[model samples]
Target: MHTQPAPTPTHCPYCALQCGMQLTPDAAGEGVAVTGRADFPVNRGALCGKGQSAAAVLSRGVRLTGPLVRDPGTGRLAPATWEAALDAIAGGLARTRALHGADACGVFGGGGLTNEKAYALGKFARIVLGTSQIDYNGRFCMSSAAAAGQRAFGLDRGLPFPLEDLPRTGCVILVGSNLAETMPPALRYLTELKANGGKLIVIDPRRTRTAEQADLHLAPRPGTDLALALGMLHLLVAEGRTDEAYIRERTRGWAEARAGVMAHWPEYVERVTGVPVPRLRAAVGLFADAETAMVLTARGPEQQSKGTDTVGAWINLALATGRPGTPLSGYGCLTGQGNGQGGREHGQKADQLPGYRKLTDPAARAHVAEVWGVDPAALPGPGRSAYELLDALGGEIRSLLLMGSNPVVSAPRAAHVEERLRSLDFLAVADVVLSETAELADVVLPVTQWAEETGTVTNLEGRVLLRRRAITAPPGVRSDLEVLHELTARLSPGLEKGFPVEPEEVFDELRRASAGGPADYAGISYERLAADGGEGVFWPCPATDGPGTPRLFLDRFATEDGRARFVPVAHRAAAEEPDAEYPVYLTTGRVVAQYQSGAQTRRVDELNKAAPGPFVELHPRLAARLGVVEGDEVAVVSRRGRAVAPARVVGTIRVDTVFMPFHWGGAGRVNAVTNPALDPVSRMPEFKVCAVRVERVG
Candidate 1:
């Protein structure tokens, strides 16, 4: 008698939505079958194509199964034993530190790493390599929103309120997020919001599929989102719709913010933003008239030179209307990566410690160092941000260790980043597959992936969910934790005790290190997560017996005065603008079919078949002017670099703007041309808008 085993419950490996799924062993025993888990409340039995096809990557030929070491004479990578690979990496890192000081060894991580891996990577850099040059790709994803949220509310959680509150809100002003394509399962929230008679306003340069469902779609010119938000605030004040009572009781610094908004009149803002005054008034009217409303932003406004101020402008709008802190009303950011929220919380960020503590704070240093059995003064201070670290890869930083990221295809001015990586004294990359960045590494380690390891990941809502191991990894592969453990043993003799190979052991240490900090996880445990039917627990879960906090700032903000701060900001031009040579605005983003860097998703057959390759999406008018039609090869040249792809002529985009999905590499790599102009506060690259010239390629 052959009785089938029960299905293993897990979450999808792709987006922040973290849709739940049930993985069952296949009949032939080749791989697992993925299906939506109806019991989980987040997705509720809905799964996107990416989620459905995630299992394909776990197949034999789809991913790396062995470690590889570069041959000095041949300049080629060849399969090698684990001992040889780890030894080479240890020697390289030690040699660099001995010759160029500890600061010369740089460590780069990604947003996809689990909480345990992120924490361990941070500890490895500070203790083993004794370097302060540690940062992750999450800096590019949510740092702008994070900086703005912290400045305004004194805390930064992706969504202070849960996604379940969307349908109950009276209106929602979605800024720059194409949820329909980015996370399909989340699109249901907007659909339910509309079904509940709530008005929806979408602000984007293109009338995307998500915008098509909006009651009003305001197509603002790129880099002008700041002006658009300020104009809305101006109209809210002019129409006498301001919630003076709420502002007086729950917020501060309104006078300066109001003065700033007043200077940008509706008619004046129209010229700056390319949105009409009537539409601005309509957006204001719909929002103010509603009993409860919410403002949610994505990468659109957060990936600019003024990203922090841009997000702050939107926050001012919410505060003026008395939206935040009220039921079903607030300002939130839609984080894109799988573990974007948790990745920043657990010390992977450049200036943060575990639990989102400031690295420069003496108390934070003492607490974390005590957990690791090290002196507080021995801990290093803050380092450079993501772009800055990449820029200094071969110069100030001589050797590098990278994990879970493919910066060669994802970073701004990627060609320059690639050149920097090539010039490094020695580079080691640990990834699930042979990513573009891995191709240039001196040593490559095959690590266990989502389904092959157990760890916790905090979603966009700050919910800490556990992803249980469902299958055995390949023979030659090892988990990232194991790799760190082996390397730590090689670098420092006695410090190996701090680097645990088991995920649960590493998590237990993380919990202690994070105790009493901003993103406390001391109360959370694998037992609790599993006992709760894998629904996951939210953060600020301080006490063992206490209920976790699902919503924040109900009665008071996290600031010292228990009130949100209103930052006064005004509109500004992008780093580069249209001129005689570069007459078009180029904006880059993701498509539904492919995820960031296309490291894992591109390997999936179904995803590749759907996306195929990159294409330059231009307005019909722009395409006509360039004498190019749909599928015609077009070259987009920017000040930084140039990229060529087939044309996608559509009427949805603005005539002066062109769009490109940053997934592929080689000639179609859009990031090769993206400007590295950073936001003053967040250090996020200006990926949303840059000046370029479009021409037809023969």
Candidate 2:
């Protein structure tokens, strides 16, 4: 190995907070001891357990190399040469296609992919596979927010305003997001700026670590966040705090929204949400009094049965106050995944094409089709969503292609997902390591890790940051771009030239693909990216001579008729409500120690040591009633499945609700018993609130 390089600072590849890290290089020039850096917008460079120990994930402990093939007889994965592996995969896939048709094959990806990688995945799925059943994990993270933003305004990312925008806000409402654990860096912005008579309102079922920082923590009844939001809007309208001028000039559906809020006032809200009328009214008044206001939400709010409606209500809050398009004043969705925005922009979703263009939009399709050198009319899509494609596994979908996602562990209804995956005639998973989902694959392609790969990730605040290569991939591991290129070459002839050999060259293709598109990523060339240096280049960077947009809604909005429409949202309870048999509301989320499904973090011993295994948090009253003490192993069952995990008795949750982290997979997988019911509009699973019964086991 070469001599070690000096230690340098980097950024976390997991969450969108993009927390900066200081990496101490080993003598071999590999990343070691990743620590928080000195200066950054997110953490000022502080890292929780996940960020601090991120380097351990890239260690040799659990990394997969070459192409892995599972032996049907032994049911164990064995290494196969790249050629043999590809031929086998190609033959099986070709056979499946001949028997079941193109509609029978599907692909699933996630927001963790870099922009270049996401664009490549989309192109590969459409041009090579010719299948419409392609979607990403965003179906679980950003669908509701995306739907709401499009319905009200025209675009979607997160936070309509930049993060520091919090400093200028008079009031900030955080709905369902656990900022302290999920995005501590974002919370740092709030905590540092939130003083001098500003209001911090938190809405959740549990009194989380974040709740402690809130000026008023409204513990709404499980699945009742929408009711509380509507009630607050009712009070805002009644108090005459809404901006009539802005509304009259920039809104379309105000009359209906006001009417709905009027019909369901504080009394109705209090009854449904269980948040007292006085507190609800006070929160509404605080928001109304603020000259600048922001409504921020995360996956907790977006991953529900009525998620889209709830997000629509948040949009109305900003539009009603006339704070939209202004710094520190607007509605924002705190995106969960690292490249969530990039994934959405690059046609990773089932219904979208490259360049933030819709599949149904003929011009958008023509633009990408021309760039890809394909017939625009030949593109088969407006594909099936994530849940629908997964549900179709055994029947129409005979082959499954999953890249950079562990849906078996991360998707709702873990048991069902695992079974569906097993039913596939062929499965190929591309990841840096052999994840839980990878273990189930017929062929697992060892892909490059964050440290070993070079690309870009769009942070939570709409800033695109470069992911410089710090180390080389292991002997056989290849970048996902490289793997995809090889796979598609075998399936699709004449398209080999499209997949460039270099990563930056691939990014150039993506840059051109998005020319004149909504997100306007066209002008962002590879040379500009290199010269732009390590800092972020905020998007809508449409011109090389023009400054990139750091904050949105600065000038009106990108809406129909040049006026933003106020989307009227009626309160709808979660898809599955608590009842006599499964009375307790079980909610799942991230922990400070691990990232999603423990695909990366669990590989890190230090992080896993801090948060070892699955633990269901229970309120003191419920734990006492259930006869389960702290550390007691218990069976948590829902309509979908069951999980046995240790119980940690705490007073953070309401007596009727239990909180569990979604990191664990084996037996304690939170998704094991979680609900998979989708929102009618967004098709996002109800991950926030599901009914379950807890039983203590010896």
Candidate 3:
């Protein structure tokens, strides 16, 4: 009889929850099976619908098996050998650099990439391509929160405290995050909080599933979160609920922030935010009466043109309440993508280097250059952000290389971005499946998926966990590291010495490259992660034998003066407001069944059955005005483009706004109508709010 292989421990591929899971071979020995790991603290043996059915996406039949290149004669994609594809890409990039200079070569990365891949990609662009036009999809996900967090505390981590502290807190105010639909496994924390006699306050434009469970739900108008926060602060001041001692001891710049909030009285704020004064006052009372309170934000407030300032307002509220730096109380951003926290920390962003170091700093440049064995002066300066780089594609950036991201379905103003991709001189994409963006590439390389690869990813709580390889990839498929190594050899032969194909080797080098920086992951190793029994290790772990930090800012903030800074901010409308021609506000979000862009999850039959496609969610009054019944086709037209989906009339949403999930492609792609106006500080495109006109379609 043949012996069976031992089960391999890993984590889910979807969301930042990174719920622990164990993979074991099926009885028929064809593919693997997923089982929840009880040892993990984040999910605690609970798996959502997406996590339970994740193994379905690992089937060989639905995945790409070989490299494909566009046929010149037929103008169609056809299978090609690895040698031919790599040579073609190398020649294309070389020609672009030779004609338009090295700045014309753009590299776009994804938030789903492992820590090793993110580090290697950033180094590869600076050393081999010698270009600074490198950024990732995480810019669209959490750039605003990152900027605000860094400004307030002098450091940025998705969550400074662990999820295990949620139940112990006295109260939690969830701002604009629909955790029930976006991350179902994480919803248990709210349930447990209520079970522990903690109060829950949910703020959203619609009465979502997450909002339904709240003790008090405040439905503010779209893009008015800043005004709501300012109003709450004003009420706290009027009621004498502010923590004067904590403000004087642990925070700075509160006087200016206080004056800013006083300008917007409760009555004026009620007009701007469409939320009654009673509700606003009630929210403040619930939050202020608790011994320890917490505030958590997500994409809703972070995907706006004034996102950085908007998040700053929320942070000011938390600081005034004396929540941050206290046990079981603080402010945290609920990051969306799988590795969003780690992806931003270790470079792959336009203005950052490994270890969350600024690219413009000479010390950062010298430190990273020494690790890569290159001169600091040879490194290029910062370039355009994600949307800007995509917009510059046929013009300044002539050649492009993309990995993991499916921007055609996920980008703001996506139809125009697709046109930009088509105009590029040459485009190369590496992915496990032929995504909507990959379908437009001149060359497409098949790569190994999550279960077939070994790497590390950081969760929302700053815990760095290892994802162990379970099964071998197909014969023709290759890992991303191998693809990068081969491409480096073909493009710059001698420079390939430092590029390692093994994940372990690349991670070891990454540790050396990240020493002494703000993130400080120098002490984490694969052996240590595995020996932790799936609990994973947190960051700022500088010593090899010391316990990692699960909580931060206990004694003092990371700022130079050891106090959090409060930035005075005012409210502003969205970039595009509803007018006579476009009388309705449009907002986009995610669903529990389908992940971003629906690249891998759409291929799973179970997920497809649960969430078949997109639909317009609107109030019954608005549906009646448009003369559209349930399941009737409707067209939502913006200045940029139009998206058509079936209508679902409900009482949950506000009358002036409509909601749609931006997961599907083609006519159902909601991103085609999203605004591309970027925040000046964070450079994140405004995706949560845009003006559009609705019409009934036969």
Candidate 4:
């Protein structure tokens, strides 16, 4: 009789929850079967629809198996050898650099990449191509929350406390997050919170599944979250619920923040936001009355043009209530992508180095330079952000290397972005599938998928986890690390030390580079991570023998004076508001079955069946005004573009607002009409709110 090997424990590949799962060999020996991992603390054996269907994407039938190059004469992509593809990419990049200088070459990365891949990609861009134009899609995910968190606490780690603390907290004010749909398994924690006799206040424009579970749901007007938060602060002060002693001891700038909230009286805030005065009072009473409470924000408020200031308002509320730095109480951001927290920490961002160090800081540059064995002066400075880099594709950047992102379907003003991609002189894409963006590339290199690679990824709670390899990759597929190693060698032949293909070796170098920096990972190693029984370890572990820190800012903030800053922020209107031409508000979000961009989730039969296509969700009054029924097609026209989808007339949404999920392409692509106006500080696009006109189609 043949013996069966032990199942490998790993995490899901969908959202930041990173729900634990086990992969066992299939009976046919071609793929692996997935099951819930009960011992892991995050999810505790709960698996969502996306997690259960994740293994379906690992089949060879759905993934790209070899390299492809576009024919010069035919303009059609054809299979090619790996050597030929790499040589073509190297030649194109070199030619572009010789013609237009190093700044002409750009590198674009993704939020889902492992820490090893993100580090290698950033290093390759700065070292091999000698280009300063490097950034990733994570800029659009949680940059506003990160910028606000850093300013308020002197550190940003998505979540300051673990998920286990949620149930113990007396009250939780969840703003703009739809965890029931975006991350189903994570909703269990909120459920348990209610079960423990705790109260939940959910704030969103639409009555979503998450809001349905809340004890009090505040459906405020779109683009009015800032006003709602400021009003709550005003009510807190009126009721004398402010933690004066805690604020005096642990915080600074209280006078300025207090003065800012005075301008936003309850009546004035009620006019700007559609929420009633009584509901606002109830929300504040519930939050302020609890001994220990928390505030969490997600993409809804963080994807606006004034996202930085908007998030700052919420942070100010937390600070005034003395939530942060207290046990089981603080402000946190619900990161979207799988590695959104780690991807930004380990470089690949326009203005950061490994360990979340700023690129323009001289000491940071010198510290990282010593690890790479290069001079500090040789490294390039910061560059344009994600949207700015995409807008400058044809003019300043002639060539681009994209990895792990499908920007054509994800970026705001996607039609314009697609035209920019068409105008590029050369384009190379590295991905496991022939994504919509990869189809436009001159060269496409096939890479290994999640189950076929071994690497470390940091989750939303700042826990660094090891995803072990459960199966061998097919013949023509290579890991992103291997691709980067070969490309670095071919681009710079005379370098003494070459890029490492092994994930452990790359992680060791990453530890050395990240030591003494803000998001320090010096103490973590492959052995330490594995010994934790696949539960993973949190970051900021400075010593080799020390256990990682699961909660941060408990003793003191990371500020120079060891005090949190209270930034005074005022409410502002969205970049584009409803006007004569566009009479209604438009918002975009996700569904329960499909993930971002639908590049991988759409390929799975079960997921596709669950969410076959996109639809416009509107109030019954709006549908009746447009003379549309539940199944009738509706045309939503924005200033930038237009999209057509079937109508779903539901009373759960606001009458003046229309909703669409941004996961499909073609006529159903919602991002085509999204506003591209960026936040001055975080550079986040206004994806959550825009102006549009809806009409019934025959």
What TM-score do all the candidates reach, one by one?
0.99, 0.97, 0.99, 0.99
Q: Is candidate 1 or candidate 2 better by lDDT?
A: 1
- Candidate 1 lDDT over 1-698, as tens digits, reads 44565788999998999999999876556779999999988899999999999999998898999999999889999999999999999999999999999999999999999999999999999988889999999999989999999999999999998999998999999999999999999999999999999999999999999999999999999999999999999988888999999999999999999999998899999999899999999998899999999999999999999999999999999999998888899999999999999999998898999999999999999999999899999988899999999999999999999999999999999999999999999999999999999999999999999999999999999999999998889899999999999999999988888999999999998889888998999999988999998889999888777678889899999999999999999899999999999999999888999999999999998898899999999988888888999999999999889999999999999999999999999999999999999999999999999999998998
**Residues 477-562, candidate 3, lDDT per residue (tens digit)?**
99889888988998889878788999999999888888989988889999999998889999988778978889989899999999
Worst 10 residues of 4 by lDDT: 489-498
Model 1 residue 664 CA deviation (Å) reads 0.4
Candidate 4 wrong stretches, greater than 4 Å = 1-3
Q: In angstroms, how far off is 359's CA in candidate 4? A: 0.6
Stretches of model 2 off by over 4 angstroms after superposition? 1-10, 22-24, 30-39
Looking at model 4, residue 217 earns an lDDT score of: 97
State in Å the error of residue 599, model 2: 1.1
Model 1 clash pairs? Answer: none
- Give Cα distance to truth, residue 507, candidate 2, Å: 1.2
Residue 601 of model 4: what lDDT?
94
* Native-to-model Cα distance after best TM-score fit, residue 225 in candidate 1, in Å: 0.5
Residue 219 of model 3 has an lDDT of 91
Off by over 4 Å in 3: none
Give the Å error, residue 666, model 2: 2.1
Q: For model 2, state the Cα shift of residue 118 in Å.
A: 0.7
